[model samples]
Structure formats: structure tokens, C-alpha cells
Target: MTKDKTGRLHVTVRSGRKRKLSSKLWLERQLNDPYVVRAKREGFRSRAAYKLKEIDDKYKLLKPGMAVVDLGAAPGGWSQIAAAKVGAVDRKGRVVAIDLLEMAEIPGVIFAQLDFLDDEAPEKLRAMLGGGADLVMSDMAANTTGHRKTDQLRIVGLVETAAAFACEVLKPGGAFLAKVFQSGAEAELLAQLKRDFTTIRHVKPAASRQDSSERYLLATGFRGQQRP
Candidate 1:
């Protein structure tokens, strides 16, 4: 980072001989991202914390005494925010987290190293929560194959699965939030969400990069409708 003539700060990462150009670019982006610096200063797990905070701030999705579930909560960024907002640290609410990767453990969150698609996930999360949840959020993304259509389908598939699980475990009037791509949900999935939830919308937080295709799907007012 350096200051130029006008005193504006600039950061550029020159590609090293051994470092791939892609890696250098990614590193440069991270270096220039203000949210990354803010997250480090605030002790949040990742810059993604701000993405949830921005959504929840505007939507008021999280509240004290609201049980929440965070799927694919590795590194626990969203889980940390959810725990704080719901007062899980004070035992006012519970946060049950599921991920295939291990997490370092947050005070208000109970974690399990298991795939969310596992047959027993719903029951296990319910038992951990002692009942239904007020919200279920996921930031999970499938490994990209670099094919645009295939990647888009993979993203929507993850959202659909998470939404279905949210319906299964959320109490009536609960909410669901998950990452979706620019393509958004397919017609059939969108129709299913409309049937299950009172409202559905797309959100893009300031923390998300402008050029990125990532967006969030927020569905609120779960009807508790039975799903086959």
C-alpha cells in the first residue's frame, strides 16, 4: 500500500515469479478490501460477518431469544454474528451450526462436523436446539467447475437444499437466508419458496465485491407448510 500525489491510498500486488497470476489478483483484492481490515480489527472471523450484519441490520432478521441455525459455518463468521444478535452467549437463544469442516468454536454456538445433507441432520439440529429454529442461514458454495451453467446450477442446488432444511427445522414465521448466484433461483425452486414462505427477495451487501456474482436469497415468514 502506498499514498500517491493526492494522498489517496493504493495497493497493488505484483505477480511473483512462482505465484500464479490468479492468486496474486485475489491477494491484491483482499489487501484493498476495507471490510477485510475492519473484520480483523473487530476480531470477526471473516469479512463475511459484515455481509450478514448488513442484511440483518436492514431486515431485522435476528433478535434476542431467537434460535438460529448456521449451515456450513466453517471459520464461524456468520455463526459469530448470529450468536451475538440472538444473545446465545447469555443463553437467551441457541445457535446450532453444521459443517463438514471443523470450527474453532464460538461461545454461543454448538457445532457439529457433519454434512448438512446427511439423513440425520434435521433431527440432530432439532435436538441441539431443543425445538424449532427462528432462522436458518447458509453461506455454503459448491466447488466451481469453471463452467458457467454448471456452477450456477450447483449454487442453486445448494440454496434449494438449505431452504428445504430450513423449512423442516424452522418454526412458523421463521426466516431463511442463503447465498445464491446472479442467476438466482430457478422457476421451480422459486415457486416452492413462495409456497413455503410469505416473502422472498434477493440481497447484495456492500461487503460483497461489486464484480462478483454472489447474492443472497432471503425468505421470511415461514408458513410451516408440510413438504413431501
Candidate 2:
């Protein structure tokens, strides 16, 4: 069970006569969600698009003609926004998106269907990009195992792997973005980002559920090979 700002428990066991209650409640919440309504009205693939938008707004990291890689990009919301914002005119701007799930094709973005944890994934991504990236954004979250600590660790591993890949491929002064739950594991990643980047901060977008613990880490000014 999670507690909201009002200090009320927002989740309950779905047992006996309440077996369907939890699912129904979730559906009700999604239907009534303002972000969901806005996403539908605006024809965005998912509400998660606003998360990247807000982060980019604060950090001023996105710009025209930048080479970007989107990790765990499924259903194509972030990729769609990135393709346009990065200036895909005549493919001068490049956006490469990868995920384990099949995604509907978004014009002007390269989509790779592969698990990022696979050893071959990075090579394939670079092959698609034809060079290193200027920005690597990861919304990758491990599939939840229902155990709190295990789930947290799994996501931390995902974030760390993405960050390591970014360090290898991002240009000097590049940016890296990844999703993280507000957990103790974030401290180590934050510390590492601070060491390699000029600035690092956590951001929670308004499009995110107010009750959710999810937040984004924005790291800019990649030290790259210059790190002492």
C-alpha cells in the first residue's frame, strides 16, 4: 500500500469479495486522469511524453539536429517527440529508439526491437545511429517482481547499465536522462553523474501520477574521455 499526500493508504488487498476492486480502481483512476485526457486530445502516443518535455524544458538539453538514442522506447511517445524536437528534416537529425516490445513505426526515427540488457544491443544501436550519440534518454524500468527491494535493485541495475552505455557513446558535454524511483539506490547513481557531468538533478514531471514515486534524473555536460 502507498500513502498519498493526505496520509491515506491508496491501495488495499483485493481479496474475497473485493478481488476485482483493485483493477477496477486502477482503470477508474486512468480514465479520470487529467494527463490521460490531455494526451488523448493532443494525439500523443502516451502521457509519458510530457515527462521528457518537462525535463528538457528545465534543463535546456534538447535542441535541433542532435543525435539522440531512446532506450526502452515502446509505444513511441518519447521517440515521436524527440524526432521532431531534434529536427529530423531530411534525416539530418537522428533518433534511434530501442525496446524489447514491438512498437508502431514512428516516421523519421529508427526503431530497434531488442532487449537492452542483451550483449549485442549496443552494437546494434550504434550501427543504427552510424555514430555516437549526443543525447541518450532511457525510460527503462525493470518489470516489477512485486518484492519492493528486488524491484528497486532491478531498476537500479537498468539505470546503471544505461548510464555506462551513455558514457561510452555520448560526445563531450552530452546529456543523459533516465527514469528512477525515489529510492536509496539513486544516491550512488547521482554521485556518479555528478562526477562525470557538469550538473545533475532529479525532476518529477506533472504528467506523472501524483501518487507515484517515479522521477527522472537529468545529467548534462558529459566529461567523456576528459575525466581525470
Give the lDDT of residue 54 in candidate 1: 98
Per-prediction backbone clash count: 0, 0
lDDT string, candidate 1, 101-126, tens digits: 88997998999999888888888888
TM-scores of all models? 0.95, 0.86
lDDT of 2 by residue, 1-228 (tens): 676677744544444565477677776576666677788999888888888888778777778888999988998889988988888646868999988789998888898888777777667777787877889998878899899999998998889889987887787988899999988877787778888889887889888787899988888889876221
Give the true-structure RMSD of model 2: 5.2
Error of 2 at 78 (Å): 0.5
Give lDDT for model 1: 0.89
lDDT of 1 at 7: 82
How many backbone overlaps does candidate 1 show? 0
Candidate 1 wrongly placed segments (more than 4 Å): 4-8, 225-228
Which residue pairs of candidate 2 clash? none
What is each predicted model's overall lDDT from 0 to 1? 0.89, 0.83
